[model samples]
Target: MRRLIGAAVVGLGIELVVLPLWLLPRSPAWGLLLIPLTLLTTPFWSLLHEAIHGSLVRDRRANDAWGRVLAIGYGAPFALLKSGHLLHHRYSRTERERTEIYATGRWASHAPGYYLRLFGGLYLAEVASVLLALLPERGWAALVRRTDRPDTITGLLFDRVRRRFLTQFRLDASAVVAVHLAAFLAYGRYGWMLVAALAGRGLLISLADNAYHYGTRLDASLEALNLRLPRPLETFVLAFNLHSVHHRHPGLPWHELRTAFAADGDEFHDDWFAAVGKQLRGPLPAGTLIASSPGVRRH
Candidate 1:
């Protein structure tokens, strides 16, 4: 009951805030509104995270329904998000993982350009990859060859990728397109604001993503890095900054995270701003390499 009510209120609030922002004028001051709006909508991802973990609600279907709704607001396909997230939890810090959200610089180059991509470029790359993923198999295969499976390509076409494209991608893609098209038709003149809102949200999400895993080692037990946020922001992000706790207790719901942290906060707490600063200042510190490379084709 608590989780459902809280998620409903937050979801409603994001829609209410975003709808009006689309009607605002396209001026410098108006553009600034996207920053707070981005913060306001950040919890949608948190709720989706809880849903993916099956902790948003006890009913499995209810969790998936809410997750799909929340993901639509953030413009992601829930099925793809679920698969990648599950892999994240299972592999934690290993290179076999398709997504870079939990990557530890273990298998790839972590140079300046790599950090730059992590900061913002990767979000744009995801949008492009999604479009490519929508293409016919032969067309996409021609563009992204069988031999070279880069992060962008692998993320969208890994193991269950075909199933996602056939079912969830087919249905969810239509819904996502319809929503954006409606928004464009209804408020085309203010389209810049919509773009700004999405870009701002992407920037903040990237910041949060880098802050969670930066400076951590590749060992599963030691990989997670927790950032201590203020009480309200911590609640808003559903204790995501307390990532180590989440990694440790994947079963706990958002509301109960504080209690778990109270009992074990010291184990993972790190300076939040300092961690963010570390990633932005330069490339990720070299991580200890794990054997069994992701590229070795199985016979």
Candidate 2:
């Protein structure tokens, strides 16, 4: 409950603080303030992630409702994301499924360019996902059939899992549109800052997410890279820094993750920036990081 309140407060602060600061009559100081304010939205995205996993709340209906609201703030459809995310959990680290969670195409495996694309166009990737979700079911189906690929999030958005929750999808879409329209009206000429904030959110989200499982091999145990982050960030993102624990015990609530990790700490990686730095340099050693964990041999 306290974590939820913190997320709500920061999410609201993004609108109240960042938007107005960006709109304030041209000033270098206000521009500087916008940087951290925009980046501060990372936890809000984390809340959306918790909701997508259905671990944010105990009640199913309430969880889905909050998922929709958070998705609107992230500018993605809740139903679409929830569907893709379930598939991701089922097929993590595989060529066919990891793309749903991270942009792991051929280019993403190569040198410094991978990090460039990961951070530089993370928001554009979200925009593409939104556009894909907007396609009619049949239209999206046709596109998938033409490509003969089900590896990307855009392709996964065409999955049939969402058919059962079509109404929720529409509601999520409507909420996103309404939120954007309201922001536009409120910011007027400087409404573009809202769009910039969305991009900023995407960059931070991808950085944090990539830090989790970016360089793992397909056959790795648990298939996750748990980094050691600062105490404040770890608390703020609700222990997502311990990515392996969350993936291993997906049913655990955010607050419970730390206790769970303490019991099976050997199975997780805590190499700090090792994985991210290795991936940034070039291709990563498959499962090498995970192999270092006690009793967890690399496949």
- Candidate 1's C-alpha runs over 4 A off are 1-35, 97-112, 137-157, 264-266, 285-299
Clash pairs, candidate 1, are: none
User: What is candidate 1's lDDT per residue for 28-117, written digit by digit as tens?
Assistant: 455455566666655767777888899887899887887777666666667667776776677655544323333454424655465656
Q: lDDT per residue, candidate 2, 1-299, as tens digits?
A: 54684657565555745556453555433544556657666667667778888887878888887777667767778887777667667767665645223333453545454565567455555545555546676775687566547544445555443456655666667766676677667666665766676678777766555556665556343666567777787887777777788778888877888888788753446555665564454445343344344433222
TM-score of 1: 0.76
* lDDT of prediction 2: 0.63
TM-score of 2: 0.78
For residue 32, give model 1's deviation from the true position in Å: 6.6
Cα lDDT listed for each candidate? 0.60, 0.63
**Superposition-based RMSD of candidate 1 using all C-alpha atoms, in angstroms:** 6.4
Q: What TM-score do all the candidates reach, one by one?
A: 0.76, 0.78
Q: What is the lDDT of residue 84 in candidate 1?
A: 64
